[model samples]
Target: MKKEDLKKLHSSIEANFKLLEPFRKNRLEVIKEYVGSHFSDHGSEKQLPFNMIRLFVDIFTRRLVANNPSSLVTTKPLRLRPSAATLQLGLNHLIEEIDLQRDLETAVKDALFSVGMVKVGLNHSASVEIGGVLHDVGQPFMNAVELDNFVCDMSVSRWEDMTFIGDRYRVDLEFAQTKMFVGSEDAKKLTATGKAVQDNERHSTKELLEKRTGFDAEEYRPKVELWDLWLPLENKVITIAAGQLTDVVLNEIDWDGPELGPYHQLGMAEVPGSVMPLPPIASHRDLHELVNFTARKIQRQIHRQKEILGVASGGEGDIDRIMNSDDGDVIKLDHPDLVKDFKLGGVDSLNLATMVNFMELFKQMSGNLDSIGGLGPQSDTLGQDKMIADSSSVQVADMAARVTKFTARIVRDLAFYLFEDPLINLPLVKRVPGVEGVEIPVTLTAADREGDFLDYNFDIDPVSMSHKTPGGQLNKLMTVIQQVYAPLRPVFQSQGITLDTSQLIRSLAQYADLPELDGLFISDDGEALLDDQPVGSHERTLDPNTTRTNIRINRPGATNSDRANAFVQGLLGQGNDEQRAVAARATG
Candidate 1:
């Protein structure tokens, strides 16, 4: 790089910092205050226990993510018929490869709490997909610590994918820095990045490295982004080898990662906020305060009524003079009629009941009490028919639908990410149906890559059996099992579909809350299951009638491993580490 260009880069970086000053001042600073004052309180005084808003939000989020009957699953974009056995088998294998349930649970909870969440993944090297997570929308622009550092451009008011890319790409750069410290490491191996020049409060990395290592250290700016270094050059085109494009800023380079521009950082299901920008919980705050304040006032009034006192005869502090007798020690009463006891009112007796009614009102506002209320007082003695007639169940179903849609989106995004930079890159075998020994290599054909990887699409849906309710799901499954028991068995057998009773039992165990019942998931074919089989034993099972084939693509003997290559690069430092690992691989 030329000296003039280097100077220009420094000036550009300074100007960008100046542009970010407004966003930091307006939005970021205000959000920090909101989190501190309302959300977090570390002081001696805390809010009342019956903060109904917080409690309801917590309960609602838990119900969505915990022991949920509806969860995310993956399938081919185009629905394949049951007769298309090859594609169905391949798709099932892909779904089994990823931990879709756990990942989506985290994403949903994070989005519900923070109103948004930004998900970023590591390159294919790490078997663990999601590398980092940021729940706070403001933190992504201010204090991001993802694999690569990126600040959201604050020039726009409403956040959208279109606001981030195309002609507006320069807006992101107007706040980005070239010579920036993307992340940090420990002081032992690598030091924190401070100001490049020696200032009053900051020291250079070169100086710190020499002091720690007792050796001279060289310094230079990293112009190219970290992901660019790993790209494999092909026909003069630098093919990206890392994760997706949004992981890096790409402020100085043209984005060549299939035009996948700024993604939806905020995935949410809750109704958006209002008034000084707070969560949906904010709407319930006023009612909670009312209940708290009224209860405290009523308690004080009740204490006053319990006291033994008389209107003092023009005395302010005469309580010490009027000492009463107790424990067989007595003071003679001159005039009993002169002393008086405080009296209570009829309304005072109803204070607690009134407060209880107010709390119920709050519940009604949130639609929590709607089920009982909608059934009407006369209909209380009725049967389960009222459960479907009430508006409460309808509202619950709508909320569940939104959450289910969000979970499906997260799984779909992760599937696309995997297809873009596939971790399982080795060859897999597909069995030839009628042939005894012949096998076909499973690989993406040219048709799969004809549209710049756009055609490699997948469909997703929530894992619910006709209903999102657990009992509803369990009953449905049980009914199907009963229908298939005596009649559908031989019908499926004739069609070469081996109906595994063990699989059905495991599903039954989940709804029954019987974890021990999973042990009984044994095959009727006189063979142990794959999961129950010992680690060292052969997994191959011989069923003369079964023609299904399962194949895995990974390093040799990697079946023992959870997944091959968990790239813990930070553990292996830069210099001589790669060479040593390569040597170890060769000699071992």
Candidate 2:
């Protein structure tokens, strides 16, 4: 048939099927009542036509027997007549009296087959018509709720069930085959040539088996081989071959495959399964390359350790010089210039190296200051542009002093931790080079050096010298020391080191200078002098031993002995003998 004619026929069938859908429930009721009446014995009271009765019987019998319904126990002939009471009630009471002449089963089957036709025509058109016709023969079994339940439980639908239905009904001489060959409109078209009609039926049966069972006798070659095949093959050979060819074509044009070169082979072989390499070494590479990488890593670690130790030991100037070097210029803390040295390395390695470099840079920067309170020369510029900048020199000086004190304390503590027995000891001078060992002679000259002169200059109190010592700077130094060392405890703990601040404080106190206060008094008639003369005298005295008494006392209050003696003599020479006796008692 021409494509246009087939298309027109399909459209008409689809329209009729839509109109028939609304009457399906009514038709089913009529057929059930008609079949029920067949068991009754009166022909005049028949509610349905004889032909309609035969058609209903044929369809129901095929469906029931094909479905193997053990539950339907009765084999009574279906009655076409209604009882007298049914007739007296009304024509409506006789359910089969309604003109339910519409072929609902055929309509539904045609609709399903049309869907199959469209699918097959667009994809594989060789077996389209026959496959379309047989697509929904299983629908009648599905209409039975019990059969539907069984199929649903088995999870088998589609062509598998259709093939089962065909096998069960033995469709060769069935009413379905008869309807397809004699009653169908397509069959009528093929009647122009009798042989063509016969060939069409034979071809239709073969196509049905192939669609439902996936067997193609023509391709399998031997006719005997067809009989040996299973009832339902997994897939037809044509479909499977088409899929395999498509897959091969897709794989051949894929650009991800290796090229025909040694480099391609090497590159493909080295490609790592994981995006990132494993620890110790990740990624696929030669053992020599991995070893070289490890060696470089160790070298870097050693270099960093040396740099850290230099900073800690007051080599800050050296660190500053190195940081300003060309190599250090490229070695940034955020984005290191590893690319300048290593030609091939990941961005991740550069980032990691930058972090390590920055950590070291921060350590060096912090280590340059003696204490946390000690600011860099540029620190004054930090907030100087602000309106409320703290430009007080006195405050800055005080802060600097505190920082010095705190730093001294931390240094003392570090020294004790490093050298003292039992982990820590009392604070003591650790003998830092070039600063604490300088000493100068302290001498006191006599101011009086004459006859009976006292050496008052010989006793310069040592306790008073402490106030002049740097010990007075301790308060400020202690504050700064605490501030600097406060952040060091966590680092020390991580390193398994313990610092004893109490011991450090005690040691600092020992070196700290604290002064004492003293008072002196002098009561002498003779002049006090040094080198046998008074401080004002330039010439030598003529009578160096002529009773030039000089008495100097070292107390708050003193009275001259000559004055006391004169007072006693005056009281002794008072008015009368009785007065003299009283004066003597007072003198005593």
Candidate 3:
């Protein structure tokens, strides 16, 4: 990289950062609501800030957890084959191994707080050791980049049309010299381009803090600003030193990672005619201010003491004594009408009512946070309340969908890292689809994964990504059992296809959100069993030396319904054998 080129890159980076000043300020304001910052108008005392922004964002974050791989992202094979099935299983386990859910929680909070953007990148040289030998392991990581630390082309209207994106971060001077620039000879002699250098003592973060937060860090040790600019057209990433060092090129490397240069952008609301996005909180800013202002006003109104005056007709001694009188204290007056007390009202009920209205409006505008949280005024019946919750979930659903799409893109990059590497090999297990108590161990080698990267379609299970309570899961399961299975079971039985209850349990347990219920049947030994099998069962008959048990026939005593009715009786040791078994299973 030439010094002149480095100068141009540095200038472009600074200009882009300057273009994002308004967005950065907006983010800082929202962050203040999160951390509870003092207002400029308020005095030295920190006035209580109504953080409805934090409240809503946090609630929505809890609602957006990708609790499982099926919830995060799914890879669908273009061609239906055994290889593709194996590949899909590998990808699913990879999602868990990487702990994408936890990273996404961190990223989702950042997106809600800022302009709603998350970046995905691969770290190829992550340090690990095997038998005392250090190895560089490749892995993908996601970042919720700070608003002030990132810059993009402002002239572009679409993300795809944007020329470049860059990240700016502070690096310790000693670390940069000893670690980053140790092997490079350019550190000894700095090349100077014909360009003015930015002041080493100042950066936007420090300046923004001093201006907005009134905090000074002048005594802190100096650090260097490092810039990583990704050029999509060239498919390369370049690093440069900012601050005191003007137009100093650090390093440049080819980016064979994602086509868009290892960085992906995600946002909630779309901003017309701009590549940048409008955060959901930005829309709620005005309402948030109104709420806080009214709350403060109401607080002051209630805290104010009532004014009382005494009209004295005679000596003022009695008036003073009467004004300062405690309980059971009596004051001697010269005349009966010596002093008259006049009291004024302290607070108005109207102010408090208005404040409540403002808060309600804030919640309504921000996707009815109160209703979603099961608080405030709700519908008369359970169904109506559910309807209201469903209606309010629309906005939160949209946010979650955006996260799902963002996660899909990240998963693609992660898959690329795994499939593209010929050296990557993984030992995995895939459960047989219809077979009960069966999982086959398989190994996926580079040869198995070698193919066009576009062979799989990426999908995100939006419904799964949205969290549900245990009660909700149970309700859903019951609905499926009653509405679908119950109606179709007889029809299938007539066609000589009897429903396998054990298989049904295993399949449902694999995907159901109820972990405790699944644990009841899926034992610690990795074997799934609803109950013990009788003698001469298929599992026991597999042993050639095992003797076959004689079959015995008996008259049917009670139907399933009768046994169900007798379950309680069986618990009291008064019912038949079948009813007792049913009761035991129920209790177990």
lDDT of 2 by residue, 1-588 (tens): 234633443344234333333233233333333343354342213333222223323432222122110110111223312111111122111112211111222222222111100111111212212321332211110111111001110123232232111100112222222343334432222211111222211222222222222332333221100000011222211110110111111101111111110000000011243211121111111222333344345456545542121233344445554556684364333322211222332223433333333332332332221112222221223233121113333322332333233222222222221221221112212223444455432211122111111111111111221122345366556765578654465575577555443334343645573221111111143432222322223322235345556875442111122222333444444245543333344211
Flag regions of model 2 displaced more than 4 Å.
1-231, 237-588
lDDT of each: 0.38, 0.25, 0.63
Ranking by TM-score: 3, 1, 2
Per-residue C-alpha lDDT of model 3 across residues 1-588, encoded as one tens digit per residue? 677866776677778877887777667666666655554432213344577877878788878764753523223544435666676667777777766777678667777766545555555455522111233465555555566668888889999987778776555455456555657665544332211133221234324444433222442544555667788877788766655466566777888887756677767878899888777787887777777777787677767756666655565666666668888977676664755667565555555545556666777787878667654435434565678778988867788778888877877777776667776688998888766579889987887764466765656566656667656766787788779866686575577565455545644665564445544664446665555542212121124355669876543343222333455354345678766654354221
Order of all candidates by lDDT, from best down to worst?
3, 1, 2
Candidate 1 vs 3: which has more TM-score: 3
Q: Which stretches of candidate 3 lie over 4 Å from their true place?
A: 38-46, 66-80, 126-136, 171-183, 187-224, 307-343, 434-437, 492-588
Candidate 1: count of backbone clashes, pairs at least 3 residues apart or interchain = 0
TM-score of 3: 0.72
Put down candidate 1 lDDT per residue, 1-588, tens digits, no spaces.
244643443344334334434422333322322233344332113335345544555455554554323322323444432212333334344434443445545444434334333332223221211122222211111111221122332344444322221101011111123112223111112222322322222222223222333221332431111222111122111111111222223323333332323233333333243101233434555676677667667657766665466845644334444564455765445554556777553225345545555566676665553242332321222243355336554655555576666545444444444345433232346788755569877653222322333434444444431225556579778877668644576676577565454555557777777778756544557554435432324323346586668784433221101011211222233325543343234210
Give candidate 1 misplaced runs (Cα > 4 Å): 1-45, 67-114, 120-161, 165-262, 265-279, 298-305, 309-354, 369-390, 422-457, 463-588
What TM-score would every model get versus the actual structure? 0.46, 0.11, 0.72
Error of 1 at 469 (Å): 8.6
After the best TM-score superposition of candidate 3, give how far the Cα of residue 209 lies from its true spot, in angstroms: 6.5
Of the two candidates 1 and 2, the one with more favorable TM-score, higher being better, is: 1
